[model samples]
Target chain A: DQQVKQNSPSLSVQEGRISILNCDYTNSMFDYFLWYKKYPAEGPTFLISISSIKDKNEDGRFTVFLNKSAKHLSLHIVPSQPGDSAVYFCAAIEGGATNKLIFGTGTLLAVQP
Target chain B: DTAVSQTPKYLVTQMGNDKSIKCEQNLGHDTMYWYKQDSKKFLKIMFSYNNKELIINETVPNRFSPKSPDKAHLNLHINSLELGDSAVYFCASSQEPGYTDTQYFGPGTRLTVL
Candidate 1:
């Protein structure tokens, strides 16, 4: 049972264009969502996060939008750069003290310069 | 300095062999966790320790064990390794046990069971 799912295996976009990655979750208990970017042979690095109380959060070029009714969330990168090419994983944490994260299979994003 | 470090970045062994992976965090976080990523790139939590106390243990096999001597170190030991155990293992840390805390992950150790 995949609690978090990213249906797209890969995505490609031209440099300086908009890039969007989608994720869906089945668990309603999850209250916090985060996005991590990972390079080859490296661990995932935190990119952005959003709390259930908020519908959208933005930091610089990255933005995350959440729709509770749809049970979905998305990460948008504007003016994508070549360095933005990496595997993106969406993770969610159940509400309460135990913040254990459930991660998706990840989406590979490629930015062509 | 590395915030989270795991020794033996790569491990190759035969089936039924016993091996251990060591992890350490210099971030002074109170919580540590072990996660496994399979060939399909699915990351799943195996165990979590807070201040050297076991807090979460997922539905893993008995052959796998996690030990934490202190808050900054958490180790995973696998016995009677199986082919299915071949995957990338990541060690992570958080400031506290709550869900709001952000986790820092290590480079990961690739374990291949022959």
Candidate 2:
């Protein structure tokens, strides 16, 4: 079963605009949400994260908003740049000692010039 | 210096063969993990070792085994490789085992089984 889901397979946004990537999870046990950006032939790099206690977390141009009631989270990039174009994976940390990560299928975001 | 590194960026092997992928981290982190990314780009955790001790072992196949000789090294050994086993394997390291710690990932090793 896919505990985390990214409905959109791809997204396109122009540079200097905003880019939003959405993710949803069915597991209520997940208390931490994270976003990772990946390039082709490379591993994923951490972007932003949010805890269940907080509704939003921001780091520079990247911001992550979490809604526990909706079981959803989103990553927003302000004034998206070409460098922001990459595959974004939304992951949630399962509540337990293991603290394992469950990832979504990922969304390919393209920032147009 | 590279934070995390994996040897043999690409590997092609025939079915029924055994192969090992080596991983090392220089960040002095206590936790290391192996993640498998399939064709669908779904990254799943395979195994994790913290301070040279096995911590998380997911529902991976029996043919796949993970060994951590120390806190900075984690290796994945696959026996009797199958076509379905082909995927990009990534090694990651974190200061701790939980989600609060940011994990750093290696470039990844792409394994192809024929």
The candidate scoring highest on TM-score is: 1
- TM-score computed on alpha carbons, candidate 1: 0.99
List the DockQ of the predictions in order. Answer: 0.88, 0.77
Please give the lDDT score at residue A108 for candidate 1. 100
Question: Where in model 1 is the C-alpha error above 4 Å?
Answer: none
Docking class of 1: high
lDDT of 2 by residue, B1-114 (tens): 989999889999999999999999999999999999998888999999999898989989999999998898999999999999999999999999876888899999999999
For model 2 chain A, give the 10-residue run with minimal summed lDDT. A93-102
Residue B99, model 2: Cα distance from true site in angstroms: 2.8
> Local error of candidate 1 at B86, Å?
0.1
At residue A104, what lDDT does model 2 achieve?
Answer: 97
True contacts kept of 1: 0.84
